[model samples]
Target: MGQNSSQGARMTSSVRVIVVGAGCRGEIYSQFASIHPERVQVVGVADPRKFARTKLQQKHKILDENIFEDWHNIVEREKFADAVLICTPDRLHKEPAVAFAKKGYHILLEKPMATTAEDCTAIVEACTQSGVILSVGHVLRYDPVTHKITELIDAGVVGDVMHIQHLEPVGFYHFAHSFVRGSWRNEAESSFALLAKSCHDIDLIHHWAGPRRCVKVSSFGSVSHFGKENKPTGAGNRCLDCSIEGDCPYSASKIYLNRVKQGHTGWPVSVICPSSLPDIESVTEALRTGPYGRCVYECDNDVCSNQGELSCDGHEVHVFDFLTQRSTKHKAHNDAPRNFGMSGHGGADYHLMAAFISAVANNDPSHIRSGPEETLLSHLLVFEAERSRLESRVVYCGDAGRR
Candidate 1:
């Protein structure tokens, strides 16, 4: 089959797409849409936050009529779109996805598909029933370097996959900015760090190791550094209000001010100052008062700063959050030397999207590598691992256990 005909129709024009959750990932997806207009067109965006939606429209030059605050509003009014990109928080993925799938729309869903296995199954069922293509966002599987590693392993370049070690050095400032003081701080609102952050790692491990039955799994994590007990004495209630804001490295004002200075704009900035707190003074004040600027130690943040060790089959995988530093490295079985490391976004998102676009254009499931079923298997493994860690017992990989 050629790269443009799932049904008998040749796709001569762009595929219409609606992007939900105009946050950080949404912006990136919008940029990709702009770059690949022939194959993808971002015709609509849905986000509840006024500032977020406005920023997405302005950044992408999308028309006001094409923007929506409520995702359901868009689904109810618009009859069709080739696909819907769900970039909402981990907890918010299900509803929009279920709705879109039922409408027979192909979906490019963000990672950690949903908080639980049931939600993930529901999404898979919805898409299956409607005959829509459902591709979960497991971007790492598509990354160039990662893909090379996988290819090498598949081709017997890597000796029989023995063990895999993956390290996600959740950077110091990044931990404070996103995981600690950011939107993902609370478990109820988001999820455990494993599910919210390292679903990619779990997915990658599953891809490399094949469906290995999880023999034993355990994890231990806690909000070690970012809890009230760790709050510094004399720490003010807010960053702007704090007397030692300049001395603190995790200061929201300092971090975002630098982000803006470097032309790094989007969800990170809008998250700190969601409204017109127009001037720098207001912005700083807003950060101090807003959720983003609160003292990491004093805030209501409940997610862990350090989670460690999940073993599947005999392959033990370890994940850590060094809140005081930033570094990332992964070692997978491959024909190559095996040691691989990278500095930035880890190329996960870039790779994942490329594969999804290619798969859609090609209209082949094999081309669409990261399907909901495979990704869900990895997600279930993580959930089981967390359970084992909490209950202090071995947990198996549900029905999707190693085939």
Candidate 2:
């Protein structure tokens, strides 16, 4: 990796950064910051979970005073830093982002921007008002593979970008862990599958096709497999206590119990909560009463595990999350479908961050290559698709003015 010489070759001269949400994405940001100490220094971290904050502090050697539970408090108490990384859940991005932006801090916002378009618009307004460098974390735009594809398409290797197709086969294990068994299990909490998991796809479609207003869209989906209706008769109250754990494909005991045995420590255990009576009683109690502990088959989760359809611009995308399946992949097509292969953040978040960082350092929006205006079109497409899915008809994405 090339070093950022402009920031000086000393860790002390690097941009002082703080990360909100010490979860998976936050951890990744911290690790990246740690590795490039000369370019970025993680000065603070915030998460409600004590374990998450403690682990991040220990991992990155952040001072105890800088480990906070609430990011708002951090922004309130501390002077403006060079940059802030908002790695919180989709729903929680707006507040901290708006807060830090007003403080004249450059922002690295996580994707989906917010749970709703209105919230997203508000965030954009806040950033614009503050004149802070704001970059959304739609990282797929930065992937070498994806960048190559974009180049080929621009070069007319893929003529006219006619009716692009994409697939997010959210590998079964990933689907189970995130959509079925993790923080994103409920639509109320996460908005919907499209926004929560597939916003990157929406963003990508906008990026490739130019600003053709999404004319029509439709979506169809069903929970299909994971729910109380599908649970076996006489199934135990919890996966760990279940008698037929071996027979069931979504056996928490088999997946998480074995995972814990293999030394896979971190949020997954707290997220999945395999044991009815967990080794850590506090975590078990938290799961029992909180959204995380509910049996995947017994939660209030209504988002479809399998969703697919076409957008008005003739672009087609399919998202099949076999919460019960095992592998994941993303495929895109110009003339025919070409496998782009699997990625760490669905190939979106990482790519988005790299581009945003480069843009900030370069002081150029053209280098951003993607922006809210373009990403918002994809958001509209998804909205239209959801509408069509419910109404059972094609919906067109009309020229809704930039939000």
Candidate 3:
């Protein structure tokens, strides 16, 4: 309620922005502008989904003319905005971001920045050339607890972080929802599992690794557990028709109905059902045909459910999962980053957005802790890790922090 109340509040913003993609990430990050009217203004919004785009429209009181169906239209018609919040999918980020950067708009892009190494470089070059502040979303570094950890390490409180045992146990159901059945299901479609999911931990590991650059990297994981062989003998292709779905932990009914039990249908549910559909019927039909409703063990998903033995800086972390569900257990002692007069006054993710808005407001890059260059190191680590996995040999990631 505290964060929601902060979001609902109205204030004036020096940094007015057009939301380029009205998906989950776009709305969550850019809504700060909607919430804190003083720090940021949601001037325009663009998304392929009309309902999603219109939702942002109603919230911000934006004109019908300002709501666009795609980034292409916004760039063609709208001459300028103070900043562009590019929250499109992994594949779509580079173009809208580079376009707006050239248009003299500061950018707050979502994570992985761009899927490809080349695309990432293009984004960095665009911002550098355009002289617009570019802050890729690396929110873990902005979290207060993470901030405290950063402080502790800097102050020698944690006996010198010689080795880190990080794990992103992205929760079984969540992994199925986002990575298995959802947008990031395969390497060819969006990105490898590592970049799409665990870039946060990779980035965090790099942040903690600090000056200790990786000399060698190797990774090995596959779709061993969640494959056709693992599918139960009596299970149908979809959850709706599947007889054994009740026993399955990753069943769609178990996932979405529980949300219904909680008196809300956000995220995983919203993803399965269209934004406009009633939860029960929508989810039912989705199970009948949609990708999300497919049996977790039966989907065409190829990303690794688990990978480990991340050897970095002479330290061997035997297991590190995507998005860090288990690493959270370590947070009781090890805290995250702290805030110092953040611009929009939100949490780590929100605060990072705030810092970007504040940086735009103050015209100071120092306001943001991680910019394009810092983000690149983490992305490079992911690339090298993937390379190591594919080539089956140690890839030398010389000077990971030296970009």
Candidate 4:
């Protein structure tokens, strides 16, 4: 579990990759192949949706024989690639991860490893036992802003990292779209709001804490705004049919259509429909019948609209706010080099993919920053924080939680 240096090793050959899920995250991670064809190539892809699979195939020039309608089809075949990117949904991570790891394919699993602690541990064990590299999707670790913050801390410019306060602004429209009426709306279907959305925040906090374990954790949050109890007096079930849609801040029409009108039809809009380029008609149709079109308060979302978690090891303290994002003016960040393209997650996506490709190509685990054990530890902390929030008590991590 060595931390990869930003200077990745030279690849002797392209690292062949099989994408297990062709959804938004899958599409984003696989774009690395298009950027660095000599270093990485997508050899296979699997998705239940034909649109997703076909979209990835067209982008990466994947063969029709290699394209699969289901991940199980990929797993059933003999191992045909050097590595696998398990970008499946939150609940669909473990099976493909274990299967690919057992097949001797190094893995790049998306964040929160799995929905539960047991499943996370199982995926880790499978990879560890198989002696294959497992890198989790903690993309923020590779972001330039994060690197600057850590560099400042290490240089003692912050003078003893005893306390850190962090805030992540899950914007109103974003929260309404992703958490209130989207795939991760229900805890049973996806995960608790914190783990589903803020695992990266917890992982960042854990990374900053450095070697100190999160021994004690207490959290507070609940479904505050986007619940049936908060529905407007005369609001319809769906935004398209609602009379108050024009006045509501979380209106689907406003959020989706406004972005289209602004010529910003990438994310949150592309996600609403199966079309590669979602237009006004497709968007309107999706709103008229799809989950994204539902009224925020009338949806079945149960995740917390706002949440906070506090972690301490009896000596140092860390605080995380999952609602507000305040700007911090820092000279170091302003002066940091911008070599990586700021496309996805401030270009951390490119760095993470580069590191993983280099790691697999050279058979060197050090090329990855978020190794399996490190990712599992951070994920455990997140689960504990969620537990504390639910039970309304501080939970002690003791020996296991420590590094």
Highest-TM-score candidate:
4
* Weakest ten-residue segment in model 4 by summed lDDT: 312-321
Question: Model 4 clash tally?
Answer: 0
- Residue lDDT tens for model 3, 1-403: 0132112223344678899888777767766754557777888999888888988899888888888886888777657568888888899888988998888888888887988888898999999999999998887777655665666677654556789788766777888898889889888888988888778888888888878777777788777788888788999888878998878899887887667667666666776665674467676777777898788888878888886323222111122334453432223122212332122212566667767877787677776777888888778888889888888787877765334
Per-residue CA lDDT of model 4 for 220-252, tens digit only, reads 998887777788899999888998889999999
Model 3 off-target regions past 4 Å?
A: 1-13, 275-278, 308-346, 399-403
Q: Please, what's the RMSD in Å of model 3?
A: 7.2
- lDDT tens per residue, model 2, 323-382: 545442334422211222122443334445545555555555555655656655566666
Off by over 4 Å in 4: 1-7, 308-343, 399-403
Model 1: lDDT of residue 394: 65
Question: lDDT of all predictions, in order shown?
Answer: 0.71, 0.65, 0.75, 0.82
lDDT of 2 at 280: 51
For candidate 4, report its TM-score.
0.89
- Order of candidate numbers by lDDT, starting with the best: 4, 3, 1, 2
Where model 2 places Cα greater than 4 Å from the true spot, the runs are 1-13, 266-295, 308-343, 346-352, 399-403
Query: Lowest summed-lDDT stretch of 10 residues in model 1?
Result: 335-344
For each candidate in turn, the TM-score is 0.82, 0.79, 0.85, 0.89
Model 1 clash pairs are 157-335, 158-334, 158-335, 211-402
